[model samples]
Target: MTFISLRNVTTLYSLENVSLDIAEGELIVLLGFTGAGKSTLLNVVAGLTEYQGEVYFNQQNMNGIPTERRDVGYLLQDIYLFPHLNTFDNIAFGLRANSCPADEITEKVEAILALLHIGHLKKRYPKDLSGGEKQRVGLARSLVMEPKILLLDEPLASLDPATARNIRKEFKALHNRLNLTTLYVTHDFTEARELADRIVVIINGELKQSGSAQDIFCQPAPEIQEFIAAAN
Candidate 1:
């Protein structure tokens, strides 16, 4: 089933005439360089940006749905954990805002912490955590919300290579275990190659190509041919 669909999604600023469909439990990677409208497309689905198009979730038009009501868990490259909050509180912030009961909040937070392997760091503050740890905490914060869709924008771009690789494995595992429909944006070819169920290439705010890894690599557009060669 198509879990998310965007039709002629032209953003007010960058993206133009874009359309994509993400199946339930599928992970789609938006592969593009900076200023390529990858993030703008993400913001469009997140309902954070104005666009002239139709965005649908489970066949229901999300035209005027507010961001909070969209049931989307968004994690950006910049992990902003509140300075005053510890790991537990940071992840619990959203639930707290929704006025969830204290006991239920603890249960949900702890489960996500364990799933992300950040259980031990729950008591520690953001300032004391490493880069990878902070990213995991931020991921935990998003996952703890139990969203139906997950949108990640270069979530591990700031990490060291070794750490990024390890977290990439964790991301794959989480996606499989949770089975959430995910749209991830990144410029890292390796990340897209390893993680995407399907890779969609965007250039200058337009979707240039989309297909399986082999399909894309076998018959890439001119720009993407250069991109693949440059990555290699």
Candidate 2:
């Protein structure tokens, strides 16, 4: 089934007319240059920004829905874990805000912690955790909400190369294990190549091309050819 659909969606100033459909459990990557509206597209679907057209989740129109009610999880480049909250509390903040039962919150939080292999850092504050550890916690916090769609905007960008590569593998495994429908945005071609099941390339606020990684690399558009030439 088409899990998320955007029909002629355009974010104010940032994203031009864009339409895309993502199927359930597909890990699609948005690959573009630094200012190509990749993040803008994700924000539109998350309802964090206003757009001109329609966004549908499970065939339901989401024009008037708010971000918190969208059943989407977003993890940005910066780890915004509250400085004062311990790991467990930070992960549970959303559930608490929604008045989920304390016992249910505990169950969900614990399950996510274990799933992300961050159970050992449950008591550590964000200040005490390393960069990679903090990112893992941020991911755990997002997954704890049991979101149907996960939107990640360069979640591994700040890590060292080795750490980033390892996390990419972990993220791929997690997506498969959880059957997550994910839209991951990144400017790095290597990262997109490594993680994407299908890649969509956006340039100058336009979707230039989209296909399997092999197809995209092997038979790129003229613009994409230029991009690859410049990158190499």
Candidate 3:
């Protein structure tokens, strides 16, 4: 049931001795303060950065695999929609790059737009859409690829409070509907508590603790307890 596994994974500078397993269809949130190697860990899983140790996706070693071939859907904190492409083309970009047939690309794009409830925004350009709409379109672009694992790096970080809350609900709903195995990275404890089936805490390049939300909230490590106190 382990869809993604990292064994003693270390990045060049940020991450060290990190190991974890994410189950199939499970949603885990990586919780940490800024510069705590959360993004570096995600980059390692997505094959966007070089790391020492083992990374496995669906039981296959992923050492030398390229990012695109790793079958991962990665959404970074910064939305990187192509300014030249409208919403539909932006979502269809990956399919087109993979040389999917024209009809198939259209079908997939339409389906994702509907699934994300952005069907009406298809004709709008990035400049014309609101922040939430743009974020959803970026999500549609990543989800349309049908990746084995979805890596979301603070996808809600930029939204207003109400919009972020609404999008969080939508993300949970989509995950259930699609049975997505997702690794969501965030620094917000409330967001982590709301979205994670399990929570992994990292600090200064090492994993401190990981457990269910109740366990983490009730019996966190000293460092995590300190963090919680400081945040409050």
Candidate 4:
């Protein structure tokens, strides 16, 4: 069933009238170059920006819902961890903000750390961690919240090729295990092909096409063909 819907969504400057529907437990990848408004679209669903249109989650209108109430786990490209906080504290920040019991926070944080294989890094600060370690820690912070929806904005963009590939595999595995309804934004065709249940192509804020990987590659729209050609 449709779990998330955007109808005639438009931003003040970046996004245009765009509509898309995402099903429960589906991973829809938004593929586009930088400044394509992919991130803005994510912020719209996240309720972090103003827009003109309708956004619904699980059949409920999300127009006026606050960001925290939306139950969204947003992982951005930067993945900045607090300089003074250890991995454990950084991951536990959200739980603490919600006034969760200390023991419960510890339990959740530890579980997430183990899930992300960052348990060993819990005592280390962000300054001591490598790129991949930081990324895992950042991911742990989001997954620990157990949000109903996960929004990723070029999460692996800053990593090296090998690290990006590894993290990509982990993301796919996590999605399958958690059955998360995820909207992943990326410019990488390979990443979209590997992870997306469906791929939606956005160009200059407009959705040009959307379909399975095979459909997109076999009978691409003119815009998609051009994008692919440009990539090649």
Which candidate number maximizes lDDT?
Answer: 4
Residue clash pairs of candidate 1: none
All models: lDDT? 0.93, 0.91, 0.92, 0.93
Please report how far candidate 4 places residue 24 from its true position, in Å.
0.6
Model 2 misplaced regions, further than 4 Å = none
For residues 1-232, what per-residue lDDT tens digits would candidate 4 score against the true structure? Answer: 9999999999999899999999999999999889999999999999999999999999999999999999999888888888899999999999999999999999999999888888999999999999989889988989899999999989998889999999999989999999999999999989999999999999999999999999888899998899889877
Which regions of candidate 4 fall more than 4 Å away from where they truly are? none
Please write out the lDDT profile of model 1 over residues 105-153, one tens digit for every residue.
9999988888888899989999999999999999999999999999999
Models ranked on lDDT: 4, 1, 3, 2
**Poorest lDDT segment (10 consecutive residues) of candidate 3:** 223-232
lDDT value, candidate 3, whole model: 0.92
Q: How does candidate 3 fare on TM-score? A: 0.98
Q: Per-residue alpha-carbon lDDT of model 2 for 128-153, expressed as tens digits?
A: 99989998999998999989999999
Clashing residue pairs, candidate 2? Answer: none
lDDT of 2: 0.91
Q: All candidates' TM-scores? A: 0.97, 0.97, 0.98, 0.98
